[model samples]
Target: MSHHDNKPPKVCIVCGMPLKDKNDYPGGDTSLDWCKYCGTKDGIHPYKKLLEGMAKFLQQTQGMSEEESKKAAKQMVDSSPAVKMGKVKVAE
Candidate 1:
């Protein structure tokens, strides 16, 4: 088998979330590179879509203001593996 077959679960490149279960993957597709929130059956969502989702998650979970959540989300997105590796692009 390929070495990749034994690799451990990957953290979501877009949101830094751990993909530790089948439910964590898009359509339960463990073969996908990103997590469920970052994609769907159609494949990875757009950068803006990911940013909004992360920002909303931050706001709801951390009780941060909308601006604060958005700022944090932007930072996470800019430094994310997908962004750094050029798998995903940021518009600005």
Candidate 2:
């Protein structure tokens, strides 16, 4: 189970963006399962594939180095609401 379950449902499970943050989509509901970037009709992310993208995003947005982002990205993404809710799974 994901460790983010106890936290508020404020982060996008797909992109790992804080739903209440300034980056939220204007005129769109933040209550959705994901943010504007990663949030899609599927309401999920291909966990294994998404990890790489997320690492870069974290590098740019959070100011983490690429190496650091790559190392830490899994904890951030795996703790999202989608994973907590069983919306997606790690690829075998």
Q: Which one is best on TM-score?
A: 1
In candidate 2, list every pair of residues with a backbone clash: none
Candidate 1: tens digits of C-alpha lDDT, residues 1-92? 34565777688878878887778998888787789988886767888998899999999999999999999998999899898989778987
| Candidate lDDT (C-alpha), each | 0.86, 0.67
10 residues in a row with least lDDT, candidate 2: 22-31
Clashes of each: 0, 0
Write one digit per residue (lDDT tens) for candidate 2, span 1-92: 44656777576666656776535743375446677666454455477656787788888889998889977878766776677777867554
- lDDT of candidate 1 at residue 37, scale 0 to 100: 88
